[model samples]
Target: MTTWRDVQAAAPEFARRVQSLFDAHKHKTIATLRADGSPRISGIETAFTDGELTFGSMPNARKGSDLHRDPRFALHTATVDPVEGNEAEWPGEAKIAGRAVHSGSIPDGPDGDLFRADITEVVLTHLDDSATLLVIEWWTPTNGLRAVERE
Candidate 1:
């Protein structure tokens, strides 16, 4: 497991792009494993602060329970349909896959809880400037950063 700061330190430019995509939106989506091992998607918001990726959930939220039971999770930036004629201008989307570790309790009492992200992968997908190719970029603790482009 790697800290968010590790990604930043290993690939500052890549981290910047991913963070910008996340910061561009307030609401994101997270995928957690249900008890049956099925994938569960939930709406969430995360912050990159204090060299950590942090998120909170309501006291009785199912997503919170899922993370407690299985820390493995995936998070993606909120996305919008690209404009028909301005696809090239689309800023693209980002995703993060990792574990959520119980870091501390929420400040507003036991109404919720806070967790830190232990990242494994960070990905960015977008169209090239020419809008003729789709580019996929990813970073991992084991591989650093790499990318591929497709028509």
Candidate 2:
């Protein structure tokens, strides 16, 4: 697994783009595994600080509980609707998949649970200028960055 800092160091431009997508919105979605191995999606806010990607959950929240039992997760940046009849205007979407390492508890009043991401994969998808081509970029600890375009 790689930290956010590792990605930045290996692929600065790709990391920047991914970070921009995450920064463009406030709320992101995190997918966790349920006990039965099903998927559970939850709204979450993440912080990229001190070279780590982290998030917190309210005490005993289902999402928190899910992570406690299964640390694997896929986090997606918030989606923005494409402009009417102008799909090219869409800013695109980003996703990070990894395992969460329990980092401890939030220092403040509410006693939230904190987890740091151990990113294994990151992806960004967007469209070409005419919206005729789909562009997909992906990065991993070993692979760094690679892109693909399709109609």
Candidate 3:
């Protein structure tokens, strides 16, 4: 099992990388399951606040609609590095899964809901190290995103 220490140890680098990827409005694709169990992908504005990630949607939109139908969704952020003279490119991606939750003030007053997700999985790809970490799979609403196992 990985501990908070693991995440903490990597936080500095991870945060820097994440910020670099998200600089000045970089859109990402948010994937979720349709009611029919098919995959749905859309580009959305991704934001991070105090280490927590969030995505917004219009009232009763499809992304929100999908969430209502099935809260399971995944967020992916990726980038491709093209090194001059190198015939190949190295791509990095991070994927996180969680249930969509409604939060913010929805104009409906206190009755409004904001969307959120309890990050269940965090995939970090470090090309220089040729390694990736798939972490905290066992996170539950009751226990939170503490690492469960490491392989």
Candidate 4:
């Protein structure tokens, strides 16, 4: 499984941008599939440590149960609304999609469930320097980093 460190080694610039977004805030969003295959979004905090992205859930939390049943997940960085006239300064957003592999248990923390991410895709979206185009950079295990710009 590819770790966040692997991504950093492979695509440092892209990884830096993505990490900056995650570092800009503490609260992020994680999406998991429900029993009926519907989408469920949960507010979560993430940690980048020991070459892995980790998060936990309270005991018997629905999100924890969902991950136990299905590891697939997509995590998004927190975002701030752009100023009315200064939209160009917006820092942009980042997302990571992958599976959560059960790592172990959380110690002294409500006996919560812990999981580490196995990254499959990472993406960053932001305004270009001129702020006239939207720049999207994405990275995957096989394809590596790729970028696109749109008006």
Arrange candidates by TM-score, highest first: which order?
4, 1, 2, 3
Stronger candidate by TM-score (3 vs 4): 4
Clashes of each: 0, 0, 7, 0
The global C-alpha lDDT for each of the candidates, from Candidate 1 onward, is 0.92, 0.91, 0.57, 0.91
Give, for candidate 1, the lowest lDDT window spanning 10 residues.
102-111
Give TM per candidate.
0.95, 0.94, 0.63, 0.96
Better of 3 and 4 by lDDT: 4
lDDT of 3: 0.57
Tens digits of lDDT, candidate 4, 1-34: 9899999999988888799999899899999999
Worst 10 residues of 2 by lDDT: 102-111
Tens digits of per-residue lDDT for model 3, 26-122: 7777898888899999876666655556667766667778887788887777555546554233334556667776666443333334565566555
- Ranked by TM-score, the better of candidates 2 and 3 is 2
The regions of model 1 sitting more than 4 angstroms off are 108-110
TM-score-best of 2 and 4: 4
Query: In model 1, what lDDT does residue 145 have?
Result: 95
Candidate 1 vs candidate 3: the lDDT winner is 1
* Candidate 1 structure quality by residue, lDDT tens digits, 1-151: 6888999999998899999999998999999999999999999989999788999888889999999999999999998777999999988999999999987687654568898999999999999998989999999899889999998
Candidate number with the higher TM-score (1 or 3)? 1
